[model samples]
Target: MSTSPQKRKADDLDIELDLDEYVPYVPIKQRREAKFQKLASQRNIPEPQKENEPDDETEELVRAGPKANISLIDQAVEVKKQKLIEDSSKTDIEKKLEEEKAIMEAVAQRKLLASVQELAKGIIYTEPMKTTWRPPRHIRERAQADHDAIRQRYHILVEGEDTPPPIKHFRDMKFPSAILKYLKYKGIHRPTPIQVQGLPVVLAGRDMIGIAFTGSGKTLAFSLPLVMFALEEECKFPLIRGEGPIGMIVCPSRELARQTYEGISSMIDFLVRDGYPKLRHLLCIGGISMSDQQNVLSEGIHIVVATPGRLMDMLEKKKFNLDLCKYLCLDEADRMIDMGFEDDVRNIMSYFTSQRQTLLYSATMPKKIQDFARSALVKPVIVNVGRAGAANLDVIQEVEYVKQEAKIVYLLECLQKTPPPVLIFAENKNDVDDIHEYLLVKGVEAVAIHGGKSQEEREFAIRAFKEYKKDVLVASDVASKGLDFPDIQHVINYDMPKEIENYVHRIGRTGRSGKTGVATTFINMNCSEQILLDLKHLLREAKQRVPPVLEALEDPTEKFKDLSGGCMFCGGLGHRISECPKLDAQRRQQLGNISRGGGGAERGGGEY
Candidate 1:
């Protein structure tokens, strides 16, 4: 070690440093406490500690209170234990009484729910109620005489027990001031024949089947009542989100639905402006966004005018419910069945949770269809203004024999017979387009609508024609059913419809709202003899001039003397029940369906 300074330093540095033998540094106080604990444990003696010494964290928690440390699990456990102890302490009789009390509460709750449901469903009568209020005997007799005179004057035929007397004017309807004002604004001073009777029956909440000529205020007859009913319902209990349609109107075509929706909307708008509660309505039909309809449904609705197909689709998807629906209208019911929508209508009805006031309106109502409609109603009143399937007396029908090739050329000359607002109806879509194009080429302002066109196009065309922007509106049969075209001076049948009921509907487009109109029909050899015979009889019945071509045809009623006026099944004078083309077609369709393992065909019962 004393040899040299360098040798000494080298010897000190050369000593091996083992990493495994290394230890982390510790404070002196902690090391001493650990050493004392280890020594006490080895000697089997307890180590002394300061009494009542609280750590900082523990002290803070104690200051916070006992609740601070209790976990949710512990609290739940405590509650459960307390409940169990209370339950165990109960006597057998007491437990039985508690159980009985729970059952009674449940029963009471169920009964309350049922009553609420009944209130929401509104009221529908099962049968017509007799008039309880009476005037003096002489006054009653005079009133009866007056009613009979009115009925006879209007050709009003009513079939029901204890039917209400028809009102003489709109003022007799007892409508709200706003409604009366609306009617006055629309230039309606008096009620039409259908409205005279229909208003009373519908306002009374009786089920009814109304058969009147087209364009005879049938829409108002049903729509006004629906408005009143919906108003009453909304006043009683306002519709919540996703709830609605206290009243519904089902049409066979989209155009009709839209028209109805717009009409109701106008009335509603007027009422709302007059300080009435808002009544929301929706138009449910094809060629519209389902999302838009769903959005409207989410906001709730009070009334809905819809076509069968779209309505069925919405019902199937559970977009909205008819739980609150108590008023239903089937406009053009015969046409609906003819279009094979009877099943859809029935299916829609199935969605209703309770009985509803059902109304069936049409220009024609065959007996079979009436019976079928009656099955769904509870003692419905049959109100017929004039004979079923009878042409509108307001319409002057003109029949001409035109060659198929020359019909297009004859159309221009016919349009000249009427003013700017003329309706030309073709049986098919292509013919409508051809007519439209031809008129346009001849520098005539014309618009055309058919099922083949988009909804936007059809609406635009209808709007243009209605506003008098277009002088002529060439359309297919789609425009015939339940479409109210105002000021239509003339209706030209470019092609005769296959069915006579359709012919009546087509002509009905012109003669509307107590206004006289001219209907010019073109018939060629392509038309069936059955239609010709029916047309001849319809012409004769309406006291119109009969074309020589149709007049030359032998009247089938002559051969079947026992068959009385017309085919009782279809109201067609051309054929008896045994020879009815409609029946024969239905039978053939039925056979074909059976052979194909499908359901039977549902045919329209001829015009009412």
Candidate 2:
């Protein structure tokens, strides 16, 4: 709307009032004109007056400058050159990666040097472990050569893709520092064949079936990996009793379970240092208070070393759960089957998750064990340290053909031959008690253990034997397998074992850890004929001297041959019919008759 001059002045005054907080309202064209006017005034230059031209249609717009001629390719090339110059400089990320690599290499060198120093000081077993970070050609070649030698020596047979090389020494493996220290403290320098081979597979997170001799350190092989796995899991998730153990080791016998628990617990204790968490382990076995075990479970355990029956009992009672279990190890799996723990093991396995790792270790791989492995393990690698059913080669076996009644006498003779620390294995508890009592009466220090004995008594007997307080430990098949007695110089088989595997395990009680030992068996007709052929084959394979009595049993017809043929009355083998007990009795009667006739003739006739 048109306004008077006075009204426009009033509007301008209103617009100029308090412009500090005012939002700009003037349009761009008017602002630019005012800016030009202010600039001309500041520079004291005359303003270019707008020309008073009539509104004509023909008005020309003027250009400020001319455009330069340029091609797209040259412009792109120039831009690329600048980009290359910028890229030639190192970025912050690249610098950081280089620093990290150097730091890692330095750490590796320090670790290697520490290992070598320990070896030099006779702390750890063997030399420093070869480093894979910057492996030299010579180092790799030497490692390969050592691995081949170990394989050849142990007769190791492996079946798996990407099977790691066997460890020659404990240091060759990447165990936690706690384990190495424990080994050093225990004077275990070299890794046994089973430990060397089986540990790598288990540590690599693969299911494995390990076959090795009884005393070949299979326990530690599985235990070490189990500790590492539990530690790794504990770091990821907090342990709770309701979730059960992250790792579980099932053994056949209570002794084996306790032994395994002790081994694992010692290492776990060592692992609980400044920066590491405390690892809790429980031994769930029979003959112990169930309430006590329940208390342990309530507190929570990272690992559970259990016997099949006891583990099943715990499961049934809802004492623990296995749905979150990550590792399942069956030590002496074949023995477990023989002990009839297959059903319990399977039932316990049902509680575990399907994604668990399984490890089955046995001295001998029987058909039952093989079947179980096929069902339980997922593409397991079989690691055979030696031939199945083969006895320890270091035992010097000698058989004596004695009557079953004379076993005690023969045992005394064996004691005379060897020094202290003798293990006497009998067939039954009665025989063990009898022998133990006889030895005690003979002023010989002895102890006895059988399945019938209370657990406390058995443990006491074992302790006595281990401490050298008792020179002789008479036992049944209960101590035949998985008991480690390092100082046993002789194993006397007072009563031959019924099973061939039991016989092997009985003799295996000696000649452990590459030490030479003597095993003497007293054979009678009852057991000799039955086990003669098997014994002969075993002795021959072990490079032992087979007695002629056993060698004679090689004939298939001799399976029923009686080796104890002798006189039934006098128990003598070389006697004629005329000299038998019946003939002697008749002769004595005739002599009596003659004596009586002489006496009557002298008394009645007086002169004859």
Candidate 3:
């Protein structure tokens, strides 16, 4: 075998190959695994374990390692378990929040469905509105002159398309016998100008914008028709519990609401006693128990007389719904809007699911209110009696330049000028209280009323004054707007109101119900020149003597004649829109709101 070198090399290679085959050879993977095990063992590191294995097993594995002091794997497993628990808790919290949100959404949807169902039921009882009532052709032709004469005699100015002719007497409307008798008992022998025209439009079921002087029977004009409408509905389909309020009257003040409530209640009582179906009405105003109002609503209501604030609150709270309400009257609507109830009014209207008969009665018709009326009413009849914002012709307005300090003393003398049953209007509640106390101390039986008084207190004071138990009623503007005191002989302005419109309303309190009365206004240097200038123009327009102080004041209206022809918005002669304090304040408010990241500033701007 060792003879040749090449042959020997070949034989050696063959032998080596055979040896390799026979030898117990380790694979590369096995070799690496062994090497890693050796390295881990030397370093005191434990082998990796499966996630599904028990923590005890992992700890055992770590402990089994030679020279291993602590189990890092066990610590890691414990940390993972804590993280899992934290993750589960977070998931549960999120799930709870989502469930709550879903529940709220479901509740809201259910309420909406319930409202819709109720509205459907309401619509079932609704009757088609009659917008016109024309007499027979022969009668219309024959009585045309008679109608014209009636309108002229009452100073009735009507505007609208296809408006019904004015009715001369209550019987012409063909009211229920009970209502006729009640009116007669109340000494309402004839319809006033507003009643003459307003009755026809309302009975025809047409929307109306009624403008008349204060105490001109506007309340009766609207209330009587409302009662009739409600009665017809009740007779046709009686209301179940929580089913009604077919008619609603919204006033601006609590006193006004109470008055309207009493007025309607009197008529309703008369009708009920005469064997008509019972018609339930509610008086909803602040300073009264909400539970009491809710209780009334639960039984079912046919009519509701309320102020904007409380009415809006009740509607929002779902105490009662306006689904069945078809007739709506807004008494002293301008005052309501002026007192910041416009938004509330609009919100309340949103609850009406169907078209309604809307009546807006006011002593004044500013352009702003006119625009609102246009948007709110559909094809409404506008009945204007005399000039808007004009002083009552029957009022003897006496303007005096009384110093501020002397006003209190002068008030006593003014009281002596007129007999008992005098109304004194002051701008501030504090002033009203002071004047009332002063008059009482001077042996004058006086009572005070303001927004600050409780509902009971205000009612008592108004009642005492109306009954002539109190000689004078010292009140803030709350009593001036639409409160009716039957025989108020005099109205004394303790202080001139900042706005001329208020002055007009203040004087309007006395000269009411076709009776002559006197209004004494006290102005001083503290009074605004703009108001003074407005007073001057109003005096001249009314044919009253204008004091030299007011007459001498420059009329800024001439400067604005080229721009706007005067302050058309508020009917002021001393200012344009540029100088309008109301507009300026509104703009400032809008800007402030915008700066605070509020939207809809443009909406407010467009209102101007």
TM-score attained by model 3: 0.75
Candidate 3, residue 269: lDDT: 88
lDDT for each residue of candidate 3 in 1-608, tens digit (9 for 90 to 100): 35798888999999999988895879997787788789879997655554566687677656655545667786678779988887787754355445545533442231111124344465332333663344445435656677778789889988877777887777768787899889998989989999988988898888889998877989999999899888888888999888879989998788888899999989998899889998889988888886766666778899999988778787888878888998889888776554245556666777888778888899877765665566567677899998777778889889999999999998888888878789999999899989988988899899999877888999899999888888889998888878888788899988888777778888998878899999999999998777777778778777999888887787756633444324545666566544555555655876787899975343220110
Task: Indicate the worst ten consecutive residues by lDDT in candidate 3.
Answer: 106-115
In candidate 1 the C-alpha lDDT for residue 221 amounts to: 93
Candidate closest to the true structure, highest TM-score: 1
Candidate 2 lDDT over residue span 1-608, tens digit each: 89999999998888789675678789987788789899979998444445675332312111111232445566678679887786679674454445545533442231121122333454422222111222234434666668678788878878765566676666656666777888887779888888777877787777778888867888888888878877877787867657658889887777777778888878877788535788878888778876766666676778998877778878888788876677888887766543235445556766754357778887766533455455556566788876766788888888888887787866777799889999999998888999999999989999998888887898899888989999999998878767889889899988667556678888988988889889898887887453566677677777888888876654442332343222222212222122234224434654666788732111110000
> What number of backbone clashes does candidate 2 have, counting pairs of residues 3 or more apart or in separate chains?
0
Name the regions of candidate 1 deviating beyond 4 angstroms: 1-143, 293-295, 595-597, 600-608
Query: Candidates 1 and 3: which is better by lDDT?
Result: 1
Task: Tell me the whole-model lDDT of each prediction, alpha carbons only.
Answer: 0.79, 0.70, 0.78
Note the residue pairs that clash in candidate 3: none
* Candidate 1 local lDDT, 249-278, one digit each (tens): 998888888898888988898888888889
Question: Between prediction 2 and prediction 3, which has the larger lDDT?
Answer: 3
The lDDT of model 3 is: 0.78
Provide the lDDT at 521 for model 3. Answer: 91
Q: Candidate 2, which ten residues in sequence have the lowest lDDT sum? A: 599-608
